[model samples]
Target chain A: MLSIVKRILGQMKNDKRSLGLLLFAPLLVLTLLFFILSDSSYVPKLAVYDMSEKFVAELENHATVSEETEKPEAADYLEDNEIDALIWSDSAGTHIELLEKNSKSAVALEAIQDTNKALQPTQKELIIDYVYESTGDNQLDSLSFVFLGVISFFFVFILSGMSFVRERFGQTLERMLMTPIRRIDVIGGYTLGYGLLAAVQSVVIILYAVYVLQLQVEGSVALCTLVMILMAFSAVSVGALVSIFANNELQLVQFIPVIIIPQIFFSGLIPIDTIPFGLGNLCYLTPIYYGCTALEMIMIQGKGVVEIWPWLAGSVVFIGVLFLANVTALKKYRRL
Target chain B: MKIEVCEVNKSFKQQQVLNQISLTIAGGRIFCLLGASGSGKTTLLRIMMGAIPADGGSVTVGGIAVPNRQLLAEMGYMPQNEALYEELSAWENLKFFAGLQRQSRKTFAADAEALLEIVDMAACKNKLIRDCSGGMKKRISLAVALIHKPKLLVLDEPTVGVDPVLRRKIWLYLRQLRNEGTTIVVTTHVMDEVTQCDDAALLRNGHIIARDTVKNLIAQTPDGNIEELFFIDNQSEAEAPLC
Candidate 1:
């Protein structure tokens, strides 16, 4: 029984990457979840209509507030937005329009009621206007925002890892090494071949998300697509490097958590700012972290490439390191 | 185009795979490394091809101490495993390997076609290797080994899964290549396969127990059979435990 177990483990030992992922993926994911769920405070954006300047100033101090005197514009703001509540003053009393299904809406309403209670005996009253009209949940935006990145990483990672695994299993990789071909030819050939495939995948996915899914991208579509392409290229390199340590196609798929899943946690949906010192900065080490960041910056934050250049450069550096690592790794199989 | 191994010693962890193994292979001749599994035949071949390094000593191909990049151009190696891409047709596999050496498909197209015909795989050259039989894969693997037209052909178990008919055809093809002045090194355990070579080294547990012509090896044995000679060599080693 001991020998049988040893034999099984010995087979696993040949695939060091799978073992590393088996140990490291859970630790990284736990770290991300601990930081993300720890913060519970909900801050609301308040839109006040025809309210007193004093009340607006006081409300601004407690929650994010925008004073709007225009009647139609204030009504539209109540109909569509991140607005937690809309405050208006009429002859009957003060009215508070609350965006329903928003947890912060209750918080916004309570702050106004508290202020009104403090001003008792001033012949004033407060009423709640619950807006049932859905402005479309921001939660979907948050989900889709990170979802684009996760999907891009998912497809490219699998394709590239399998491609390299096929090269090894077919023995064509060994044959290629036996030829007069240089190490650069082997690595560069794979990069060019799969890199083009990844580019096509990126183009289709990004275009479909933008045009078909109608996911709003604030920045230039060309630039957003460029970010995803760079992400795909880096993902391909990661797959190749990981492929060197995997023994089979099954071992290759085990890298999904180590390569793609962790990025979803550190993505903007989770508050990276609330994360503690050293662990927060550690998220920057993952290549997909940069991808998710750059995507969020373009699609949601309305930023150009100039603002996200540092993150994209980080991705290029990752690709360069993985390329060098893959070339050096071939030495283990052949002296040349 | 001469290949020589001198004092080649290799070890895997605590076990010695090859110890001071040496042989001289003449150009335009069929030489065989005759040994059973674990006798280090494959290790010795890999070292001479510069695919792996020996723990001690050196290998020279055409008077150039090997593990040299430029020298690799003249060396062709077919490993024990089937090395062709399953998804690709035989023609595509041949074209790719040939393109590695000459970098032009058109330049080596005729050479590849001729090699396929010699291996009796011309009719199925356009079929995907995934759909080919075990013998056909081995045949195309041989065709790929010769695709570059290297001066030295180092083949490890070239006829392992081949049928008897294809095996005979392979021996004839190896002889033809030998006549055309290509130095071929074939490794196998079957005693009859060694008879086709000009010179053969019978290895036992990382040592060359005997190196001689087929007739001389047979004449030296009391029973006068190649199989009996192999036992005589094995019994002597089995009696001396220190080796």
Candidate 2:
């Protein structure tokens, strides 16, 4: 038993990557999450074309509001702007026009109405209209919008990571090292093989989320599926790279809490912008964060690819780096 | 293709695995590397296969350095452990490996089927390796290694877990491969396995103690068996222990 323990520790001591993973993966995840989910108030942004001085003061107390001049051009300011809603005030009551309808916008509109209701003892009704024209018919699944992207990233990451670890433990990778197969080609082949399954999976998930669950996807079905596929591909690359550092399946599973779970918080499932200011930047570190953010932009917010190009570009870069890291990790087995 | 391992030295931190080992692997014959578990057989084979770097010295095959990927396609290497995916069927394993070896399925499908039949694994070609017994996995691994019809076959303890009958069949297949002008290098701890090889090298404690034909080796030992040589060496080493 002593010798057995010694041998296991001896093997682990030499494997610097596994040691680093054991010591730091969890710490990293916890640190990021602690900062992200820390106590902080989120202030919503609201703009008014023309409003009563009393109403503006009441709204400013609860949100970040701008008192713009009552120009006709300010109506167009509500289009694709950061202002959650346009609060129009007249003699009758307070009416709000929403540019987009999502959890964030919905919450913002509700807060505005609640604040306006308290302010006006005379006016009783709050009128809410949408620029994109929401029928207010369906009960939208808000979390699944981000969950759809996050889960796809999560599953693909695990599958690809486990498969690579299995290949190593079974000696299949060692056999490949013996053959004439170029290391990059091995990575490419795995990415494509898993990428194919991931692509199909993403489409099925999108269809299920959109048509079956009626999850309120507002983007092009085809483009949303393609973005999901790209996210899956990025996940595959990440999985391959991460699995290289793990020695076995159990060790690979250890990566889930560190790599997969934290991305849920960062992936906009809980509204990343609401997580306060400093921690919001850390979302860029996770690939799933880009995918989830992009999905939210395209699906719930009805933005096109051009709007989410930075997130898309960031995910592409993540995949590229992971692909290189995977190829380099194979160098431990065979120099070629 | 000829492999020349020149004064190869390897160490794992403090424990030396190979000690200035050198050997000339002649082409077109069956060569057996007989040694016990820790006698550096796998390490030496890995060096010859160009899968790992040597601490000192070098190995060259067909006049190129150990790890020339272009020349590696001509060599089929099967490590001590059976290197097949348990989740995949025998056919899938063969197809994936052959594809990685850059052989088109359309071109090598018949050859792969013939190789499977040779290993007597045709019946379970579609069954997952996880369901197969230990011996079946070894046989499937053998079939995969030969899928590309490599010119130089390097095997490390390829017959470790195989049954006697199947082992006999595999030896015959190796003999056939050697006769077809494929240079074969096989490592085994079993003394009897060396008798069938054209040439043999005995290693103990990371040193090649002897290298000769079966006839010459048997003639040199009193009991006319290589195991006698192994026992004599072990007995002497015990009487006068190394510092």
Root-mean-square deviation of every model? 12.6, 13.7
Error of 2 at A12 (Å): 32
Displacement of the residue A293 alpha carbon in candidate 2, Å: 1.0
Q: In candidate 1, what are the lDDT values of residues B160-180, reduced to their tens digit?
A: 888888789889988888899
Please give, for residues B1-243, the per-residue lDDT of candidate 2 as tens digits.
777888888998788888877777788988988888899899898888888899998888877887889888999988778887665679877877787677875878799789888888998998877789988888888988898989999988888788898889899999999999999999998988988798887778877777777778788789777877776644322121111
Q: Which 10 residues in a row give candidate 1 chain B its minimum summed lDDT?
A: B234-243
For each candidate, what TM-score against the reference?
0.75, 0.75
Model 1 regions lying over 4 Å from their true place: A1-138, B233-243
Give the per-residue lDDT digits (tens) of candidate 2, residues A1-336: 222223224333444564455334433443343345343466778887678888788877788888767644434686646677777767787667777667667667767877868787798575786554433243334444566777678777877797788778878788977877778877777887677767777877777666754556677777788788889999999898889889888988998888888888887767667788678778888888888878877777788878989888988898898889888988998888
Assign candidate 2 its CAPRI class. acceptable
lDDT by candidate, in order shown: 0.74, 0.77
Question: What fraction of native interface contacts does model 1 preserve?
Answer: 0.55
* All DockQ scores: 0.24, 0.28
